[model samples]
Target: MLKGLGESLQVTLRKLRGLPVVDREALEEVLKELERALLSADVKVELVQQMLENVRQRAFKEDIPPGVSRRDYVIKIIYDELTNLLGRRYHPLTLVKRQLTKIMLVGIQGSGKTTTLAKLARYYQKRGYKVAAIAGDTFRPGAYDQLRQLLEPIGVEVYGDPNEKKSTKVVKKGLKYFEKKKIDLLLIDTAGRHKEEKGLLKEMQQIAKIAQPDEIILVIDGTIGQQAYAQADAFNRTTPVGSIIVTKLDGSSKGGGAVSAVAATGAKIRFYGDGETIEDLEEFDPVRFVANLLGLGDLQGILQRIAEATSTEQQEELMEAFKRGRITLQHFKMQLESVAEAGTLRRILSKLPGVGKGGPFSGLPVDEMDDESVKVFLAILRAMTREELENPKIIKGTRIHRIARGSGTHPDLVRALLKQFNQTQAMLKRMRKMRKQRGVPGMGGIPGMQGPPF
Candidate 1:
């Protein structure tokens, strides 16, 4: 996920900050380092060259406001140029004023259009918009069933023929049916195409002409590197593509392909797929994304997720328990689940101010613990009655043995879990007291802790 690139650029920035004053020579060196990092990450060479040129031109321009530090001025210019390289703002799908907004998704095969459709449906559902997905991808086996299964949980209706062979007819009927039913948004997932497949391209053009979608989203796999630019360009010539959604960013080693695609296509990236969950899709925000790309944190998004997860009443209760040295194994299990949902721990920790390559426990293997282990721990907690969760002191050896049997884990594993839970409880008590002394009232989620937007 461009992790190395971010790390390298931060090191360069730190070196620049240590210098007495920023001048042309220092700026040139910094730009050169950044260009190398971007190119190494598989960003298009042309785009990288132009971006550095923009940085240099803006840095030396007389238009820079007075009294700004040279270092700060250069950073701001770089930020602006990067933001411009990425699409500046999200483009809302504008339906022809009075009609339903119909968006047809297109891309090469294996680009994740089907899953992205469900994610987008759920997003619209959360915003109180009535959405239904049409399984227009008749070519893919199980397309109808897959959409139905994934969208059913989110309460979105799926319209398609399980045995339909005509793609255009299916989409036409699906859209007409939904339009009368008054669904606010209709997202159609078309069959993926090879860039050079003339038959597929003609079929797609027919589908578009029949449906006349208001917006077309090109789903590009982020891991493909700069080759994604060519894929997007090919699709653009075949049919109008309104925006882009970069998928598989969670595991992409070189995400610069996403950046290069944005720069080359001039299409606003609408969303980024961060994880495998239905809620893992997030709107593309330039300022926060670049900050994260440069190894800076997105504290605001973290706080927002925390606020959504924990209620005010629960926060007060948790803080009170922390202050009383009563944090239990149950609470530890809940916190672990929350962290797991937030995304990879290392990626999250990497964003904090002082946690990096040389920071404390930086050598600790990230996510070494498996999900099965987490599940086992949760099972052990579930075996506990309310009394045991609230008061760990009462669980004697006999009870521990019974708990292990009930939870289907070894007694030694149970004991080890309890020991770790105790250590975490003690740490929380200390943090709680410090916060209380500082006049903070509750266990609000830690400030400046960034994790996945999901």
Candidate 2:
């Protein structure tokens, strides 16, 4: 969601890819560009310098592996360094199954802490957890109402008392209420407290003591840039923040600053809010995030999103078919349905290698296809016989006409689907060969059947 920084990085990588040779001089030029980009994005100067130093050492010293281009190797080093700058690995919320997991959210005022709490609650609720939110923001007017309005619609129960000015008392009562209900996750939204507000900070400590939260999350505003470090440090000093959530990243130009600063604090970033919607929160993954930023795409992230959009049974069936490399037309149709349900074709394509912004295939008209086209493709597949669907090679010109008639679509559309299916099969064959060469087990193919056809 750090659009500015992502675009800047992508442009720098694109220039590097065009270089005749990835020598020390080229590497130095690229690192200079990166330094400017990072500083302009408000990233901490020290972190940026450290990351560039690491990248420079590896880019010039590392031996290029067989079957890899020097340009690609340099790009890989940048990706690795940037990922490490964010966080080396993903840190998931420590929630015990079938037990109450109390998460206390603390941040400064206007940091979108209340909204983030709702997003977190919805995130857990979707995973089958019995989630309840406690609005302990006694200092903010209508904070309880705001949380209730955002949470109740999502079926997450909200526990708050506007009359109770004592935040600790509210948390204590909310904890008791959820304990009696045996809720799986209890999210406590504390009042925003600045470092200067010792009274508010002390109140946060009191609430933490009373709630005894399993995890204390500091929600920081992405617009704050490098100042996020001070905010997080102040909160950590008060209640010992275990995790961080950066909000409003979608609109913040300084998102890089906030994210990198939080990483500098040694606090794990558990989640990030990219949009205003409740479903916009996503678990932060360093590798995937950097991959997307570098225009390499995040196939794993796209697959995870697709899995979440589909049912458990559907996911299992898809995974089994993929493992066997036996993805049929029926399976392909199901995948398209899942992709449509998950997001638009443009969004899905943005996560595919060489297809996202600044990638080689970025100019493709993925945005032109809409729900109607997806439904028409599914209809054409439904019109096909079981044998033809299972063995697409059996579908000849005659079968294409018949299927088009049965599906009430143009024969050209049917032929287009077949062409797309053939392309997908070819891509899968190439992926299988690559996996074999790399000694990787399993199909190692794209989770979806095919890339979006322009």
Candidate 3:
């Protein structure tokens, strides 16, 4: 989703970095390129122009503090403007413990409100909350059953009177029933409507009055583009939208439109649904999002994942190699050890830059290789000298045989290790190339690395 926008943004930034001096003309060209990328993503023309003008004004006025380069200064200005275009800070859901926190969801019909309600319920459940949901969408034929099937399996009880005609009455009864259940998070799925659908809108207002939810959440479809602003505006006008959730981003080229549109309405985008699965929801963070958008590859997210996946000492060593933008046999061994403990090689491999299933390292066994295979790799790595470990490329056919003899393994196994090492090195080279392609920093997710990252 918005992959083309990212690519175009990267290209613009790359061209900006190539300029020898930061001047008015160069800045103008870069901002124009950025404008095209944003427009292509269906961002509203007025918003894009406003944001670019902000970037231009800030980039020229701010003084380069101390050691910062002029190029970096301008880049930082652009990055900040883009981040502010979404939202300056992360707005998390207000979840209270040992009590019922009622959250009512609202959106236009066919905007994924019900599906997002189910996913939100699942998200809270996974985080140790005692969640329950009320199917207040009585107008929909199977709304009650849908909520039952989606939430019941996860141990979240669904409260809905399918035969009830009035949504407000159903919500009132469901709230009273769940009051005895000690539900921590009570979700209310309201009826979807058009801004002009007075009947449904009245019902939604009635549900809100009866439920009196702590928060009113608006779920927007990512494919709706700039029209999302009108929907958000209408809902906010009715009940004052507290937050937003964007769905269908996995299939929407106009995701930027929905995001920016909601942002324009001054509603904090709390979460986004990237895929259809219940677990596809993610908390929205503007900095991480903008980083990924500009092809910086979610460096902060990658860092947190790596820190959780690897041991502290191994994490230090691995991150050191990341800073250097190289992976030796020693680093590879650490990765295998971590994989053995975590048993999540696929999880790690999938997030790595340019090294997923069909990536440069695709030929290396990802899913098929098991614990026993890891042991073999460790034994072979142990047989190598420091020089050989540092520079595995120098180890040819003869060195492979020698290592096999030292480790008491077959030469074929040794060759396999070397092949994987080559693949790993190739993957690192590709990551470094991408990192260097960045017009600003945060590409490889390394904190102290020198040079701008794409």
Candidate 4:
């Protein structure tokens, strides 16, 4: 999603950094490049012009603080401007504990509304909330079946009447059904309708009146680009849309357009669907999103995930070892296991500074390894002796063969695992040395390395 835009912006930034001196002319050139990139990504013309103007004004007017390079200042200005374009802050879906929060989902047809409902259900369920979903979309064929198939596997109960044609009645009955269940969150999946469908809109209004939902979310399809504005505008006018969810962003090159267009309408984008699975939806964070676009990496998100995957004592111990510039196979194994829950290997690597495109690990094959491959690597490690685990240099040809046999893998896999381990160790050692030279302990003092606010 918006990968091309990100790459273009990265190239422009690289060019700006390579210049001997960044004058007003160079700044203008960068802005032009940025404007072109945003336009190509289907961002609204007005929004792109506004963002470029802001960048230009700030780049020309702001004084270069002492010790801060002019290139860095320009980069900061661009980042700020882009973040503003995408809504300046994160808008989380605030849920009250022990409260039955009724969330009504509305969107156009084929916008991935049903799938997003399942994802939302999984998200709340993982947070220890008693969540259930109501499939009020009786217009679409198999709407009930689809919702049931997606939600039931994740332990979220779904209520719907396939033969019931009245969406309002279905919602009313579903609400009544859950009233006695003590459900913490009830997600109502309303039928998708066009803006001009007066009959459908009236039905939606009646359903809303009956449900009295705490939040009415408008789900937008990212592939529609700027055309999403019409749907968002129409829905907001029909009933006050509390928030928005943009779906199918994973492969949509026009995702930028969808996001920017919706933001322009003043409705907060609460979440976005980045993949096909139930766990693919993520809360939209403006700062982190802009950082990834500018190739700065999501350091805050990564650190927070790491903290969540490890205990405080484990964190302190790891920090101590990192400070000492020593990372044994044991530590590596722990990190791999912990990061498995964090996200995919590519996602984790992309969040690391100097590990993304044109970064230190850009050419590394570790990003190509999936979860199963990682598990196999872990198994190979488990087959090794304590001595070999501690000192990988002792693993010879026969030792590698024996471990591979024990782990049900080939010797080449064992060698590949060792190579990856060595590469990771080397990268960590280099980072530690760089931090030491800067008089920082571990990675704490590094820019963008701070943990997220829990």
| Highest lDDT model number | 4
Candidate 2 local Cα displacement, residue 73, angstroms: 0.7
User: How far out, in Å, is residue 393 in model 1?
Assistant: 86
When summed lDDT is taken over every stretch of 10 residues in candidate 4, the lowest stretch is 353-362
What TM-score goes with each of the models? 0.61, 0.65, 0.63, 0.65
**What tens digits encode model 1's per-residue C-alpha lDDT throughout 1-454?**
4557677777777777678888999999999998888887788888888899988887887344334466665665675577666654445443332348889888777788888999999888787788888999988899899889899987899999978898899998997788678788899989875555465466567888988887788888888878777656655665655677888888776676565676577666778887777888877766557667765543334332332333222333444554454666555555444333332233334343221112111122222445456557777888888888768878879889999999988888779778766665555566667877888766444321243111
Clashing pairs for predicted structure model 4, backbone only: none
Determine which window of 10 residues in candidate 1 has minimal summed lDDT: 354-363
Candidate 3 segments whose C-alpha is farther than 4 A from its true place: 195-200, 297-454
- lDDT score, candidate 4: 0.76
**For model 2, which pairs clash?**
none
Tens-digit per-residue lDDT, 316-400, candidate 4: 4555665566767776565555444334323424443322122122233444556677678878988988898888899988999
Clashes (backbone N, CA, C under 3 Å), per candidate, total 0, 0, 2, 0
TM-score of model 2 vs. true structure: 0.65
Instruction: List, residue by residue over 175-257, the lDDT tens digit for candidate 2.
Output: 77777898888889988755454664666678788988888887888988998887666665655546789998898889988
Q: Extract clashing residue pairs from model 1.
A: none
TM-score of 4: 0.65
Superposed model 4: Cα runs more than 4 Å off: 195-201, 297-454
Q: lDDT value for candidate 1?
A: 0.69
